[model samples]
Target: MSNRSTRARIGRRVMVHTPVGGSRSVMMGAVAAVTLATLVTGCGGKSQDHPSSSAAGNPAIGKLPQATTFANLKNVAKDSGADAAGNGTVAHPTAAVPVSATPGGPPVATLPDKELGGPTWVPVVETKPGWQRVLLPSRPNGATGWIPAGKMHTAHSPYVVKVDTSARRLSLLKSGQSLGTWTVAVGAPKTPTPAGRTFIMASLAPAKATYSPLILPVGAHSESLDTFGGGPGTVAFHGWPQKSVFGQAVTHGCIRVPADALQQLAKVPLGTPVSISN
Candidate 1:
């Protein structure tokens, strides 16, 4: 995430199943140039006290923990049941999880129909028992499954996110679609926040991190973002300096909110759909 988020990398998780239905394994993959790629895009920031100069102006700043690097550790159900293609090693760290194509590959029964765009490298969301699962490439395709959940990660998670840098606030959206909004800190005058329609690709619990909207990637730890850049520094939502300046037009490009706001955003799921406009 630190440097690869801006590259031509694709990420997805290996799938596993369980009694609870279906789930995905921990995410793994290499997204070179993923998180900070759009840092140069011309997205704007928000502040009731001061607005951005870009098209996507004045996003609200919300509450977020004072973090420079954070992760949302997602547990997989364990892979006691993955198709057993052989021993597969996880890939380099990035926002997306990576599963090396097995040597012999999975069992024929476990493979998805190639025509249906079945089973390929995908970012794992949750894992289950006796099955490996992944996001279906297409609609009606839903999710692909394989492997058992016992050896992968864990099962299920409880957390959601909502970001409003223009208002300088983030909302914690629960499973019920409700949320708790708070303030946050974003990019600074040099490392301003980026703007675009983005979502949480991966997450990990926070450590001694200081950046808001912390993400969970592989090695260096970077969040997966699929936002369309508007211009140089055009993307929205990114980490910034945690300072006394919350409501002010201060950043190189991206919006700068507070710490609590980024923490709330860290909970959102990958591809969670965002619509940022002035």
Candidate 2:
């Protein structure tokens, strides 16, 4: 009945689904693989129970931004000027919207309006007239899909998180200005942190706050582990109590930041862009 006991139970449940061939020792001391959708309240205080997938429906075709070829869908990082301007745009689906492989194309997937009990806010990487190409929180890193822009709410996030895996550093930026840079811990060489552009998928306060007071799940998933802790191998930015781990590569795939850094990051809004580089 105590909070500690409750958290212990949750932690145990999450750790039950370890990697296929990995031992308990291998998973120990790594980031806890808590289920993103079930563990905690997200930015909007909602919880989701399913992963992003296709929904059965004939989606309405709206006026597309432009007549670009399907090839453009592969260019996930080519934002019209959002990334370059240092202020990325975020999109929120007003409803469960159908996603297309290309602008005005047939529905490939249906994007839920919420994830982890919060508003599903995704970074808009590319744009056509009535369509916006946004990052997806599904399998295959760097996945993107086009959705009708007219049916979504839009906002610009001034905060950007940059992690340099090679240097073991994390930087926070706002409005093209650096807030601060700190030494952080990245993934080990074998289970290396994936390098790409992702957004803050959700913010969670775990029941067991011993490992970290807060966890910021990103859109990216672990490349090495198909499943961890009874959930998809989703990576995150969290605090590590061990000071010695700073500036080291010794995690499963999460970025371990200092207490101060975590405090600052906890304020960052979900859907803000995060750029991880080698």
Candidate 3:
């Protein structure tokens, strides 16, 4: 048995050694002293074998989950695909290798909220290895802002940004891992262009086959967004407009990262990362 358990047995043995009534008072005092010592030991004071908390090690740690929308930022059901929940990974920003938590342990405890940073910091692999949720803290107070852990890698965390423009090919990157290349569309010379690091500000998969073609001529189909004032550079990477010349630049500025890529891109929530450039 564990050290604490063993000591309790010893205490019982000591009390059993007490003699007759003449030595009763003295033995009673000794038993009381031994009992007090046992209590302290059981609580993990002097015994090195006890399974105290410190000895158990802090095991409740993980990355913050991806939020549903950039609007209210709440926990909601996620979509399906490579970016599915538990599909997101932990990595050093790029070179990711998946990892899981110790099974049968306690669920994640409440942590603090921290400001989100990114849409600028881009790296294929993290120099220092560790996992940190973009929003959840990893500790109690100082850790509350965003939860981060060393055990997780790039295959089971969360992704906050993704883009796929169908010009000649498309590019799909999650968290930091890449799903290979894909052809995409770009805005024509007439349509300036909207290229920069952007996140999933919002998304909507209409109950019907809703599509926006006019203003987005020659580009991917519409996937409503919380783009600038919810318009103009309303960045959305989607499928081709049936009658539209998708392989050509015809957007008002939104980077036309092709349509078929939408299913994969849609997996990310608002605030997920995105990078747009020529």
Q: Write the per-residue lDDT of candidate 3 for residues 142-226, one digit (tens) a residue.
A: 0111223542223343553333333444566655577656555554454434433333433433233323221111111122211
- Which parts of model 2 are misplaced by more than 4 Å? 1-48, 51-87
In candidate 1, what are the lDDT values of residues 25-95, reduced to their tens digit? 33334332223222322221110111111112212211111011111112212222232211121111121
Query: Which candidate would rank higher by lDDT, 1 or 2?
Result: 2
Which pairs of residues have clashing backbones in candidate 2? 46-117, 47-117, 48-117, 64-130, 65-128, 65-129, 65-130
Task: Locate the minimum summed-lDDT window of 10 residues in model 1.
Answer: 64-73
Per-residue lDDT tens digits for candidate 2, residues 174-203, read 887999999998888877898888888888
- Output the lDDT of residue 151, model 2: 72
Q: Which segments of candidate 1 are over 4 A away from where they belong?
A: 1-160, 185-196, 204-241, 252-257, 262-271
- TM-score against truth, every candidate: 0.31, 0.74, 0.34
RMSD of each predicted structure: 19.0, 9.2, 27.0
Rate residue 155 of model 3 by lDDT: 39
